[model samples]
Target chain A: MQNTALLTVENLCVEIPTRRGILKPVDDVSLQIAPGEILGVVGESGAGKSMTGNAVIGLLDPPAHISGGQVLLNGKRVDNLPREQMRRVRGKQIGMVFQDPLTSLNPLLPIGDQLVETIQEHLPVSQREARDRAVAALDEVGIPAASSRIDSYPHEFSGGMRQRVVIALALCAEPDLVIADEPTTALDVSVQAQIISLLKKLCRERGTGVMLVTHDMGVIAEASDRVAVMYAGRLAEIGPVRQVLTDPQHPYTAGLMGSTPGASLGRRRLNQIPGTMPGLNAVPDGCAYHPRCPRAEAKCRAEPRPPVSGSASCWFPGEVKI
Target chain B: MSALVKIAGLTRIFDVSKPWLNRLLERRPKAFLKAVSDVDLQIEERTVYALVGESGSGKSTIGKVVVGLLAPSEGSVEIEGVDLHRETDAAKVDHVRSDIQMIFQSPFASLNPRWKVRDIIAEPVAARGGDTKGLSERLLEQVGLAAGDADKFPHEFSGGQRQRICIARALASNPKLIVCDEPTSALDVSVQAQVLNLMSDLQEDLGLTYLFITHDLTVVQHMADTVGVLYLGRLVEEAPRDALFERARHPYTQMLFEAAPRIDAFGREVDPPKGEIPDPINPPSGCAFHPRCPLAIERCTRERPEMRQLGPARVACHMAEP
Candidate 1:
C-alpha cells in the first residue's frame, strides 16, 4: 500500500495446468523492493528464483499462469495486464537480463542492431537516436571503445563483455526495475565480479532497483540491499541483506550461508540442507522445506502457510528470532 | 614426496573456423583460437592441485589433455613420472587412465540416465578390467549413498546424491589421481561442500591426488594444497594455497582477490574487479591480463612476463621480476 517500493509481489503463486493436475512453480511468495535497492532472490535451480523473476515481468510462457496474488510495479498492478500493455511495460518499465547472454543475444545480429531494436520496439525513438543511445549504453556498461565495437557480433565479445551488452540493453530503456536472472553465473570469478560491480554501479547511478536471482550467497551478501531467500516457490526468509546473510534466522538461510565458500569458517564441513527441493508438481503437504529440515515437527506438516516471523516456516524454528 | 602428475608446456588449439570452401564462399577469413596455450604444472601425491581461471582461460582444456580426452597441440604430460602424451604405452596408459578418473561439472550429463547408478559407478571398473562387483556396494557406501539407491535411475536422486554417485564412480577404479572439472559447480552449496569434504576425506583416507579445475575460488581455498592461476591459456602464478590466496603477488591475482565476492565479517566496502576479460583470440600482446590490469605498465604491453620465482611462490609478471 506504501508508495515507497518500486515493485512488490503479494502472495504470488504461479501454476500450470498439466494433464495430471495443477502444478505450482511459484507458491505463495511475497516481497518488496524499494527504488534504487537490490533485492537478492536466492535458491537452488528449481527454487523459483527465475520463475519469480519471469512472473514479475509477466513473461511466463504458455501453460504457466499467475493463478494467485498481485504484482505491483510503481503502485500499479502489472500482473495479468493486457498483452498489448505488457509489451509496452517489458524492456521499458521492468527489464530483464537472462542467465545466458549468448542465447538471449542474437548471434546473427550485431550488438548495435540488438540494442537499437529493443529501444525502437518500446520507445518512439528515431533510428539515429536509437543507434546513438545504443552505443552510449554499451559504453555505459564499461565496454571500452563501445562506439566502435557496437557493430561487432555477440561472438566477438567475451562472456563477461557479452553479459555487459545484455545489461546495456536492459538499462538502455532506463527501466525502473531490472530483473537479472543469474546474469553472471556463466562467467569466471573475476569476470563475475566485473559484471556484478558494473550492474551495481549502474543501479546506483540510475536509481534502478534490481532483483538478482542467484544461488551464490557471496553475491547476495555483496550486492543486495535486502535478501529474499526462497524455497519451493515460497519466501523462506526476507530481511535486510546484512542480517539475513550474516546472522541468518531461517535454517535454510543458515544452511546456505554455511555451504558458501566465503563464510570464513575453517574446517566446519559443508552441511547440506539434507534433501532436494520437491518437484513443482509434487510439492510437500505443508511447509515445502519441511521434508528437508532436520528440526521439523508434526505441526510443520499441518502448517500450510508460513508462520508470522522474519523468515521462517516451522513449528519449531531456529532461535535467531528475526 | 612424489608427484602423482606433472605437466609442462601443454596447449590445445581449436580450429573453430569454417572449412576452406565455406570460408571462401562466404569471403570470411580463416582463424584459429588457442584455447589452451603452453603451460606447466605439478601435482603432488595425495594432494589436490587446483587450476583456477575464467572461461577461455584454458583450465578445462588442461583437464581434457590430462585425461587423454583431447590431445594437446604441444608439450608433455607425465602421469606418475611416465610420459603419456609422447606415446601411449598401452599397458602404462591403461594403468594411468585407471588411476586417473574424471568427475565432470554436470552430474546429470556425466552420468547415463538409461543406466542404473550401480552400472554408472561400475562402468569405470569394467573399463579398466578391474573387479566391478567387489567394489560396487562398498564404493557407494563410502560416498554416503545407500546400496539400495544404486538400483534407481539418475533422475530419481537429488543433486547431492548424484554428485555422490559421481565420486563413487571416480573411486570405483581405485584411482590415485582424480581430475575433478567443476565437479561441484552444478550442485547446491551444501551439496558442493559435502562433495568437497568427501573428496578431502577420500584423499586423506585413500591417498588420492586431485587436479581440481574450477572457477569458484572458494572451493579451491578449501581443497587445494597448491593453486595455479591461468589467464588466456597461460599460467600467471603458482604457489602454495595459503600463499596464493593470502598474498597473491600478480596484479591479476590481487585484482581477483578483490573481485571475488567474500563474506564480509567487518562489513567493509567491496570493490570487485573493474574491467571485463578481453577477447581470447586477440588477447593482449604482453600479459594476457594486462588489458584489465590496473597496474599494467608499458613493458607489460610490449613484452610478455616470464614465470619466475619470487620468494617461495612462482609468478609470471614484469612487476614480479627481482
Candidate 2:
C-alpha cells in the first residue's frame, strides 16, 4: 500500500512547546493515500486530525513544529524542504481547502483573479490562458455562468457558492494531492451534500489523492475509500471504509460508529463511550483511550501505549463485537 | 395526550434594509428577511419535536420564539393552555414563562468565562428568585460532571464538559420544555455521542419535553419523536420521525435525505443538489424551494404550496403524490 502511495506520512509527530510543557498534538500517526483515493481522517477536536493535515502540508503555525515525521509526495521527501521550497511544493503539488471558504479566499480580489493568479503562479500558462482555465475550472466545479460570475468578489457569492469557488481554486492547478479539512462543515445540510459530491467528482475525475479531515462520519463513509480513526493524537484504526465502519477493530472506532445515529439505525439510545478523550497534558500513561474504552483491562491501563500493529493500535483489537 | 406547546401562524420578520439615509439615497425600498414564516406545530408533553433545516431555514428563529427570547411578528405561542404573548393575565404569563429553558450552540461563547460553573448553573434559578441552594452540585452530577468541579471556572472544562455545564444550567430552572439548538454540533463525534446520550437519559428520567433544533438528520432521527423539515423559514414537511424517514413526500424533504451524508449509504453517488438556496429576502415567486427543487413545475413557480396531508406526512409541494 505504501509503495504506490501518492502521499505517505510515517510516524508523524507534531509538538507545541507550551508554557506548562511540550504538547504533542499529532503523535506517531501514519497513513497513506493512493492516486485517485480519498483517505478520510476522522477524530474529535484535539485528536490532532487537523494538526496532522497542517503538518503534512508544512503549514504548521509557529511554536507548533513537526518534531518527528517523514512526509513523502510521490516518493520524494518534502517534510525537510526549505521554507521557499516548501511554499513551492504547496498549491503547486498539494492543494489545500480549509474549513472556512471566506478565510481561504482573499476578500479584496475577484474570484477570477485569485484563480488566475494561483494558476499562473504554479503552472506555465500565459495571463489569457490562466484566465480561460480559471473560468473552465469554475464551470467544472458546477458554478453557473462561470465567465460572468468569476468577476464577482468572494463576498458576493453565497456560502455554498464560495465553497465551490474554493474547490475550483484548489483544483485549478491540477495538483496531485488535495488536503480538505472540514470543507463542508460550515455550510447547511443540503449544501453539504452538494459540496461533498462536487469534491468527490472532481478528485475521482483527476485521479487526485485526497486527505479529507472531518469529524463527521457520514462524510467519511460517503466519500472516503479508506478511513483513519484518531483518538488522543494516535491512530486508533486504519482500514477500508466499509470494514472499519461495519466491523471496527478498535473500541474507539466502534464507539464512534455507534455514537453516530445513522450507524445505530433502530437503537433507541446512542452507544456512548463513558469518558471524554484526554487533554494533551494528561494523556494516560498506557493506552490514551483506555480511560474511555469499555474493554480496557489491567494491561491496557498499566502497559505502554500499544503501537499500530496490523490495522489498529489496541491491546485487544477486534475483541469487542460492534 | 395533550399538546404542551402549540405554535400557530408563527412568523418573525427582520428589517435587513440598509440605513435610512443609504436606502433613501440609493432609491431602494426597505428590505425584510422573513425568518420564520407561517409555521404551525404542536409538541406533546414528554416528547421530542425536532426542527431540521439548512443554515437559513429559520429553525433557530423558531427555537428563539418558543423560548420567549424573540417575539413573533404574527402568531400566538401557547404553552399548556395559555397564550404567552397575547394573554392578558400577568400571573398566567409568568407561570408559563417558568416552564421554558434553552441550550444554545457553541458552549465556549455561551458560558461566562469569569464565573464559576456553580454560579453559571445557578443563574437561571437565582434570576427567578428561587432558592438555588446546592442546585448546581446536584445538576452537575446528574449531567455526568463531578459535584466538586462546580467551583471551577467555565474555561477549566473542555468543550464537551462545558456543554454538560450548559445542560446542567438549562435543567436548573426545572423547566418542562428544553430548546436545544445544535447542542452537540461543535463537539467531536465521540463527545457528541456522550452529550446526546446524557440528553436522552435526562429526558427519560425527568419526562421532559424537547424542541430540538439541528441541521443534522442523523441527530434528529435519534432524538426526535416528530420531525419538521424547514426550508427558507417555512415548514415544508412535518411527520412522525419514522414515517418521515421512510417516505418523505415533499421534494425538498427527499432532497434533504439524499443530500444528507449517511453512514449506511457508503460510497453512494449523490446527485449534486440542483441549485443553491434562493435568497430568502427575495425568494423565488412561489415555492421558496422551486429553484433548487428537482420536481418543481410551472405551478410551483407561480403559487406557493400550502401544507397538505399526504399518507403519513404533511407535505408542502404541489407535485407530491396524493
Candidate 3:
C-alpha cells in the first residue's frame, strides 16, 4: 500500500524575510503521503503546519516563499513550477479546504455555480456535465436533497453543510491530493466528526491523498493513517498513527499524546511541556524544542540531531528516562 | 456542598426580525430566535460544572447569563441565595457581580492588545475601586507566569501565556466563581492541557466554583466534576463526570461521545451523525435532537421529554430508562 508515494515533501523550507532577519517558519521538514492515505500534521500555533500545507499547494503569500527543497506530487515537481503553470495545477492536482467555510466560499455566487465552475475549470467538461458532477459531489459529501440544495447560496447552508459544499467544490475538480487546513476547527464537535468522516470516506473511495493539518491530537489520531508531529518549524516525529500515538519515539510526541485530554483519562495532571515555543526570530541554536524538553541534556543543546533510528528526530528517542 | 449558583427556567429570546418598513417591503413576518430555553442548573460550591454542547446549543448563552454578561429574558439567576436579576440592594448585587468573572474563548481577542500584562490583570480589581498595586504580579506568579512578565504587553506573549494572563485577570477580583466559555478551544493540545491543569489547581487552592462551557466532550470529562449536555437551547443530560462519560443516558449525549475523535480509539471508523442541527430559529416539533438521534421514536417528534432522574444522571429523553 505504501509502495508508491502520492505526495512527497523533501526538506521543504519556507522563509519569511522580516525586518530583523530571515525567519524560517518551516525549516527542513520532510514527509510523504501514499495514495488514499491521510498524513495528519499536528503542531502548535507557530509550528509551521499550515505553512507546510501552503507551500505544497503553492499558495504562500508574498514575503513568505519556499526557499529550499521540492514538493513532488506523484513523481512531478510542482514547487519549482512557474506561477501560471502552478496555478493550473493547484485546483487540478491539489485541492484546498480551509478552516472557515464562509471565507473559502464566495458569498455572491451560488454553491452550484462554484462547484460547476471548479469542475469545468479543471476538467474539459461541458456545462451540463459539470452540473451533474457538482450534484454527485454534493451527494457524496452527504448533503441532503443535493439537487435542490445545489441552487442554494453559501449562506443558505448551515456551517457543516457549507463545509460540505466547500469540500464538494474542492473535490469536484478531481484533484489527486487535498490539503485541508483545520477543516473542522470552525465547526461544532458533532459537526466536526461529520466533516472528518466525510473527508476520510470521500478521499479513500477516490484513492486521493490528504494532508490534514490541525492542532488537535484527537482529530489526528482518529483521522490519519500516518501521523507527523511538528514543533518550531521542524518534524519531531512521523510514523504509523497507532505507533506514534501509543509509543511515541520523540519526547515532543510523547508529551503531546500525554497532554491530550482524550488520552490522559485517569491522570490527575497532564505532563506539561515547560516554557513556550520560541518565536521565529529567537529560535534556538540546536534543537528547537530542547529548551522546554524535560529530557534535555548537554549533548542535545550542543549539536543538531537528525531523524533518529526510526521515525523521530531527537538525540534520545523513545520514552524519556528521568 | 452548598449551591454557589442556581439557575431556574432560564430563557433568552432575540428578536431577529426585520424592521416594520423592511418587513412590509419584503412581505415577511416577525421572527424571534430562542437562544436559551428553560435551562436549569445548580452549580455546587468549589466544583466544576461543565456545559457541553455544539454551536447554537445555548451553552455560551447560559454562561453569559450566569456571569451577568447577558440577562435572561425569563428565569432567575441566584448566586449565594440572592437573585442577581431581582435583587434591588446595591451591595447584594455588587457582591454577586464581583464574585463572578468570565473568561472568553479567544485569548487574543479577550485581552486588550495595547495594555501591558500588569494593567490587564489589574483592570478587574481597579474596576471595583480597589488598589491595583502589585496585585497583577502576585496573580501572575499564581498562574505559573513569571513576575517580570507583568511589564510585557499581551502581544509579547504566546497564545498559552496570554491565556495564563487571562486566568490571572479572572483571579484578580478574588471571585468565588468564574464562567469560562470555551477557554481552551483556541489553544494547542499541549497548551490546552497546561491551562486545564492550572485551572484545576486554582479550583482546589482558591475554592472556586466554575461554570465551564465547551463543546469538547473529552475536555468535559477531564475538567468537570459534573457535566451537562445541551442541544438546541435545552439541557439534554446532566450527571457526575464518571456516570455521564461511562453511562451516558440521552441518545444525544451518546452521539456526542461517539462523534468526538479520541486518541485511544485510533483508526476506528466513526458513524457520523445523520443530520445537521435543525435551525435554532425554527427548531423541530418536540425534542430538538430528534431529527439527528439514532434512537428517536415517533413519540420523540410528537412531545418534548422533560428531564427525569435515570440511574446516576438526569436525562431528557423518552427512550432512556430509569
Candidate 4:
C-alpha cells in the first residue's frame, strides 16, 4: 500500500523571495496519499496548509517557487515539469476545488459550457459526449435535475448548489487526485455535511486520492483517513486520523485537540497555546512551535527535533497533560 | 435576572426582486425575501445568547438588528428597557447606542486599512465625544496586546491579533453588550481557541453580555449560555446550553447536531443532512424545516408550530415532546 501511494511529497520546500528576506512558507514537508484515501492537512492560516496543496498541484503563483524536494504523482515527478505540461496535468490528472466556488468558476459562462470545455480539454471526447458526461457528473454530485440545472449560470444557483457544481467540475474529467482547499468552509453546516459526504462517496467509488486542506478539525476528523498537522511550515504530526486526534504524540497536535470545543464536553475553558504562529520570515530557530508550546524546554529551542520513527516531530513525543 | 437586551417579534424583509421595468418585461411579480420572521429573544446580563443556524437562517440579520446596524422592518429592539427604534428622546437613544458595540466576522475587512491601530480603537470613543487619549493603549493591553503596538497598522498584525484589536475597539466604548457575528469562523482552531478564551475572560472580568451568532455547534456549545436554533428566519428551538446539546427537541436542531462533525466523535459515520434549506423567498408552508425533517408529520406541512415551552427548552415542532 505504501509503494502504491497515489501522490507523494518528499522533503518539499517552498520559498517566497521578499524585500526583507527569502520566506520559507513550506519547509521540508513530507507526506503521501494512498489511492482512494483522503489525507487531511490541518493547520492555522500561516501554517502553510494551502501552500502545501498549491505546491502539490503546481499552482504556486510567481515570486514563490518550490526551492527543494519533489512532488511525485503516480511515481512521476511532476513538480519540475514544464509550465504547459504542468497545466495539462492539473486538469487531466489532478483536479482542484478552491474555497470560493464563485471565483473558481466563470460567471459569464453557463455551468454546462464550462463542464464541457474542461472535459474536452482534458479528455479526447467529442462535444456531445462531453455534454453527456457533464450532466452525469452533476448528477453524481447530487445535483437534482442535472439536465435542466446544467443550463443555469452560476449566479442562478444558490451558494451550496454552486459549490456542488464546483465539485462536479473538479471531478468531471475523472482525475486521480483532488486537492480541495477549504472547500466546505464557505458552506453552511448542513450543506457542508452534504458536500463532505458527496466528496467521500464520489472519491471512494472512483478510487481517487484526495488532499483535503482545512483548518477545521471536525472536518478533518470526519473526512480524512490520515491526518497531517502542520505548524509554521513544518510537519508537526502525521498519522492515522484516530491516533493523531485521540492520542496526539506532538504537543501541537495535543494542544489543538484539547482546544477544540468539539473534543471537550461541557463548558471547560479550552487549553490554549500561548502566542500566535510566527510568520514565514520570523519562524524561530529549532522548533517553530517552541515559543508557544507548553512542553517546550531548552533542548526544544536549541535544536530542530526530527520526526520520530512513527510520525511526530517533537523533542518529547507522546501526550503531555495540559 | 432582568434582560439586558430584549428582541420582540423582530422581522426584516429584503426587496430582492428584479426592477420594475425588468419585472414588467419578464411578466413576473415583485419578490420580497423574509430574512427574519417574528423572532423573540431575551438576553440576560453577563450571559451569552448564541443564535446558531445555517446561512439564510437570518442569524446574522438578527445580530445586526440587535446591534442597530440594520433596522428591523417590524418589531422592537430594547436595550435596558428603552426601545432603540421607538425611543423618541435623543438622549435616551444616544445612551442606548453607547451601551452596544459589535465585532464583525472578518477582522481584515472590519478594520480600516489606512488607519493606525491607535486611531482605529479611538474612533469609537471619539465618536461619543469621549477623550481618546491613551484609550487605545489601555485597551490594547486589556485585550492581551502590548501598549506600544498601537502605533502599527491593522495589516501589521496576524488574523488572530487583528481580531484582538477589533475586540479592543469594541471594548473602547465600554459597552455593556457586544454582538459578535461569527467572530472566529475565519480563524484557525488554535487561534480560535485563544480568541474564545479571551472573550470568555473578558466576559467574566467586565461583566459583559454577548449576542453571539455562529453556525458552528461546538463553538456555540462552548461559548453560549443559551442557544437558539434558527431555520428559515424562524426560531425553531431555544434552550439552555446543556439542555439543547443533550436533548435537542426540534428535528432541525437534532439534525444540525448530528450533521456537525465532532472531533471527539470518531469512527461514527455521519449521515448527511437530508435535503437543502428551502428557498427563503418561497419557503414551504408550516414548519420551514418540515420538508427536510426526518420526523416531520402531516401537521408539520399544513400548520406552523408555535413556540411552546417544553421542559427546559422552547420548541416549535409538533412532534417534539418534553
TM-score of each: 0.93, 0.98, 0.97, 0.96
lDDT of each: 0.84, 0.91, 0.89, 0.91
- What does candidate 2's lDDT look like per residue over B224-312, in tens digits? 99999999999999999999888889888888888888887789998867877888899888999888777878998999999899888
lDDT of 3 by residue, A104-145 (tens): 999999999999889888899999999999999999998999
Model 2 misplacement above 4 A: none
| lDDT by residue (tens digit), candidate 3, B1-322 | 9999999999999999989999999999999999999988899999999999888889998988888878889998899988887898989898878999999999999998889899999999898899999999899999999899999988888888899999999999999999999999888888898999999999999999999999888788889999999999999999999988888889888888888888787887998877878888899998988888888899999999998998889999999976
What CAPRI grade goes to candidate 2? medium
Task: Write down the C-alpha DockQ for each prediction.
Answer: 0.55, 0.80, 0.80, 0.70
Model 2, range A64-164, lDDT digits (tens) per residue?
Answer: 99999799999999999999999888999999999999999999999999999999989999999999999999999988999999999999999999999
Expressed as tens digits, the lDDT of each residue in A48-114 for candidate 4 is 9999999999999989999999999999999999999998999789999999989999999999999
For residue A109, model 1's alpha carbon misses the true position, in angstroms, by: 3.5
Flag clash pairs in model 1: none
